[model samples]
Target: MQRSPNLANSVSPTNIGHVVFGIGGSTSTWGNRKSYAESWWKPNATRGFVFFETIPRKHLPWSISSPPFRVSENTSKYKDYDKHPIPQAIRLARIISETFDLENKGVRWYVLGDDDTVFFINNLVDVLARYDHDEYLYIGMNSECHSSNSLHSFEMAFGGAGYAFSYPLAKALVTNLDVCLKRYQTLYGHDHILQSCVADMGVSITHEKGFHQIDLHNDISGYLSAHPQSPLVSLHHLDAVDPIFPSMDRKESLNHLMKSSKVDESRLLQHIICYHNPTNWTFSISWGYSLQIYESLIFPSILHKPLQTFTPWTKVIRPPYFIFNTRIPSNDPCQAPHLFYFDSHIENTTRGGDYILTTYTRGKIRGLPACNHSADDISKIVVFSPIRKHHLNGSRRECCDVLRIIGRDAAELKLRDCLENEILP
Candidate 1:
């Protein structure tokens, strides 16, 4: 198997070499099932990448003779219809592993995906560059958590739309599947099982937010629009099309869409290259501990901090009280803080009262004094403080009174000094 030319500089034959695209189901989107595979999946399988489609025994088409891929079906091993899709897919993957003799091939990367996926190989290549071929078992995208007790929150596996695993890792995964499945039986979803299984193996899972799995009804247009510049391994349009021939004539529509859409290859490649930049920050944050107040507070304050810091290592001077500590969550998109600074210089200055305070919960900007000095218009002198829970019911009067007693002149001088020394050059 050959490797991606872009990765030829770094990826050796022994490194990440082969890409296995797992297409499950008998759904015919184009003319036939096999045609769907040839038109949609095969072209993306560049030099080093191999495409394999897994279909149920009943759905296997005869035209698929001497098919480059092998087909696996649900057997007596999976008597439980309750576990239909997941177990069936797993079994098929195992069969592929054995059929290809991948166990001994030292194949490091295998992308487990669906048939409906349309991928920009260039974007995928960018994602593959981040990890060496040795590191396998990667999930392309994750589903959003909507509930507090959702089991999905506990693990990091994305929609089973598509994922990649190293050959050794896949072997290890199959070896450990029975135990993992037994333990996490309470978790109903396949993705949840995947998460629990991989996490138990201690395999690091890389999540690509740009990888959209079109499971919902309205997702087709939304996903298609997003894909032009998306760094997606592949899109999984599960149940988006039926298995029967001429199913809604969607294949033609899809083909037409792909043809009509102006996919700027250069722009798409640029988008994928830049995709890793945003993710670098996300991966940097350790989610081991719960977020803290200070962490929350600093997140917003340092929204542009990374961009600034990475620019020239040029530190952004901030107020003395505005110290940044990773122990507390900063105003990160993932863990945004409740408090935010009100910059008058910026347009749409909603929060510009005597105290320059804004409601963190409501996102409303209103002007008010640090104290009840509404007439003073001392917005510049009084720095807005975060509404800590302890300050509710006006119980923390001492702190407020102390600042008020310091007087506007002293406060202005202090702020000016801090600004000059800390923020500005």
Candidate 2:
């Protein structure tokens, strides 16, 4: 059998083709972004060039091509919202066209980054290598700030942390942008518009945990040093967070974050794990790896919580840093191409045993029709979630039962206890 795709291994710059960096920022941030590009992306930028698609500004110290993009203050969601110049959002098509023009030069990937976004080029190349760039592809993290994912696809690659477009996708979008422009939210924002445009093209954003759109307002070093054991891809909102190096400047922060791009193994949770359940207690799985068990089964923490509680937790079981690895390859989720991200939160409730649920970030909500997978393909795609068991206060250790991912509704999965592992005949 083939081994799972690994982004840890390094790849050469040539193999990465052309990853066009679409840096978005207003006049105030343009200087900061340019400095960031020179300091961070450019020096390490063997794989791509920074494409700044913007209109000219006075004393801005930079110039851009005037590609005659339409700027509309009107959108389906927001009206008369001229928070920024209209040209900012309109430049997306031009950037794509410029990259498509490089199709003759074998430009394979187009990456979009904010003015403050910092990317680990090596890790990016390695990650992109796992997928075929020739196919219709849009790779990035899901919307961390967008609440209503259903209204507008959460499959959007948050532009803050930056997203990518394969050669084929870039071609389709830029080529048909004029005709497709009328169909999407023009002034909604570059990212939302792009997501709407791509969804129309039958391609969804592929989520990768590495690319971080750090939607926060604090120092991230504490979080980074304790990051999961995966390749650290890209980071955005550098200016928003505390300096990577305490009391240091942006240059120092960027350097420190990049230099310390080492993988995090503090939790030792990596792959998906599956276990057979044979007990009376029903399993409540959430946050991707954490499990909550009770006599009566409950809902996935991701989606909802039952009106009733899981069993009264008299005991607490901490398994000396739980195992997060899984034998199930993520690509196994047949027909539905989604990138699963593993994460968790500790619930220190005064009521019962402190609960923590492992959550998997399900990408898009499309049906399995797009999957077009054979039964064999579906069979091979088993979601091996993590499982562990514990006893009451100072009680004996309980046996480990299985927890299953019932459906794509990560928020709600009915997991029942089974006596034996569900082995296929």
Give all TM-scores, in the order shown. Answer: 0.47, 0.51
Model 2, position 112, has a per-residue lDDT of 73
Off by over 4 Å in 2: 1-14, 25-27, 43-85, 102-104, 146-152, 261-425
Task: Report the number of the highest-TM-score candidate.
Answer: 2
RMSD in order of candidates: 18.2, 17.7
Q: What TM-score would you give candidate 1 relative to the actual structure? A: 0.47
Listed per model in order, the count of residue pairs whose N, CA or C atoms clash below 3 Å is 15, 20
lDDT of 2 by residue, 256-296 (tens): 33432322211221211223233222332322222322322
For model 2, the local distance difference test gives 0.46
Residue 129's C-alpha lDDT in candidate 2? 65
lDDT of 2 at 200: 85
Give stretches of model 1 more than 4 Å off.
Answer: 1-17, 27-36, 43-69, 73-75, 78-106, 144-154, 219-230, 238-249, 260-425
